[model samples]
Target: MGERLAGTVADAREAAPAAPAVLRVIIDAKRFPALGEAPPRHVLGPLRLTLRAHEVLVVTGPSGCGKTTLLNLVAGLDDELDGRIERPGQGRLAYVFQEPRLLPWRTVAQNLALVLPAGPDRAARIAKALAEVGLAEAATTYASRLSLGMARRVALARAFVVEPDLLLLDEPFASLDRATAQRLRLLLLDLLETRRAAALFVTHDLEEAVMLGDRLVVLTASPASVATELPIALDPAARRDEAAVAARTAELRGALRDLGSLP
Candidate 1:
C-alpha cells in the first residue's frame, strides 16, 4: 500500500505543469521625454536587465537617477521607452508603490477585494493574505482608522494576494520610522519566501538593498545605466543576523565606492 501511494504521488508530481519563467530580458531600453519643439530630455536607459523566478533584484542609485522610471517601464506603465522587454505570456505582474494608495472609505478587506475576481473562495483568500501579513483582525477596519504601519501591511497584503509572477516595489518603506520599516522588511522577506516571485525592488537606502536583494544592481546618475552588479552570497538565514547584514552592507558600499556611484 505504501509503495502504491508513493508511486501515485510521484506520478502527480510529474503530471503537474512546470512554473513559467518570471521575466526574459530588457535589451538596450531607453526612456526619453516627449518630442516637441524642445530638445528631448533623456530620463533613463540604454539599459538592459533580466530577472529569474524567485530572484530578488534590488536597484540602488543616487536620488533622481530614474530608478522609479525603470520600474515603470518594466510594469508596462510606460511604453514610450526605446528598447525591448520580454516577459512570459502566462505571467501576471503586480506593483506596490511608495504610497499605500488605499481608498480612504474602504475597509482593509474591501481594498484587497478590489483586485481579486469574485469567486467562491475570494473571501477565504483575502483572509489568508491578511493573516500572512499579521493583519487578520484588521480585515474589517477602514483604511483611515489603521495606523501607517498597518496601512503599509495592507498594501503588501494586497500585492501578495494577487500571486504575481513579478513584483515591482518602489521604495515601499520610505518615510517610515526605522522600527516600523524593519518590521515590514522582515514581513516582506517572509512573504517573498512563500510566494517565490521574481521581484524588482528600488530603494535609496543601502541597508535596505543589502537586506533584501539576492543581486544588487547599481545605476549611474540620471539617464541611468547599470554601473555594476553585486551578488550577495550570504545564506537566507544570514539576512536575519545583524552581523551578516552589516557585512553585506559594507561590501555593497565598498563596491559603490569603487564605481563612484555611492549616494
Candidate 2:
C-alpha cells in the first residue's frame, strides 16, 4: 500500500502540460473579518494545499480549526477573500451541509428536484438518488416529517443528484446514531468510489478520517493552518465494523498526538 501511494505521489509530482487543468488549491492568503466585537477578529490563512482529480482529502484538527471555513472557500460560498483556487473542470460542484438544509415548504422529492439539472427525466434521477441514501420511501414525505438522520440523507441525496466533479461534505454524518452514521459512511465510500468525485471532507472524528482519506490533513485550532498530511494506512475495504475500525482509530490517535492536534 505504501509503495502504491508513493508511486501515485511520484506521478503527481511529474510535470504536466503548462496549463495544468487539474483541480488545485494554492491559498497564498485568505483572510476575512471576524464575527464578534471587541477586537477586529479574522479567520486567517496563507493556507496552502492541493487536491488532485481523484483524491479524497479529509481535513481534521482541534476544535475551531477553521475546518468549515476552508470548506466554504472550496465550495465557492465565500468569495469575499483573495486567493486562487483552480477547479478541475467546468463541471458542476455540489455540497452537503452539516444540517439537512432542505426546504420545509417542499416535499423531500421536490427539494431534491430543486438542485438537479432541468431535464425531461429528472424524476428517475431523484428516485435513484433517494434509493442510494435509503430514502426511497420518504419521497412523498414533507421535510418536516422526517427524522434528523433521514433529513440529512435527503440533503446528501440532493447533493448527489448534481453529479458533481467536486463534492464538499462538511460533517454530513455528525449528528446521527452510530448505526446510521456507519451506514452513511459505507454509502459515502460507495458514492465516492463509484462516481469518482474528488471530495474534501471535514470532520473531527479520527476514525472517519482514517476510513476515508487517501491522505489526512491535520490543522491547528482556530485561525487554522495545515499541520500535516499523513497517509492513511488501511485498505479501503477495511471500512466497516469493529476490527479494522478500532485499529485505524488507534493509529489515527497516535498520529493526532504527534501532530499536536490532540492532547
- Model 1 score (lDDT): 0.86
Tens digits of per-residue lDDT for model 1, 130-247 = 9999999999999999888998999999999999879999999988999999999999999988898889999888888777888888888878888888897567799888788998
The lDDT leader among the candidates is 1
Which parts of model 2 are misplaced by more than 4 Å?
A: 1-22, 34-38
For candidate 1, the per-residue lDDT at 193 reads 86
Which pairs clash in the backbone of model 2? none
Task: Estimate, for each residue in 1-263, the C-alpha lDDT of model 2 and write its tens digit.
Answer: 99999999888878543433345666655666655765543564667777766577888777666778777877888876566777866667889887878898889999999987789889999999999988899899999988888888898889888888788889999979999988888888888887888788888887887777777888775666677778775676686555887897898788778866662
User: How close to the true structure is residue 121 of candidate 2, measured as C-alpha lDDT?
Assistant: 83
Q: Model 1 segments beyond 4 Å from truth?
A: 1-21, 25-29, 32-39
The true-versus-predicted C-alpha distance at residue 161 of model 1, in Å, is: 0.3
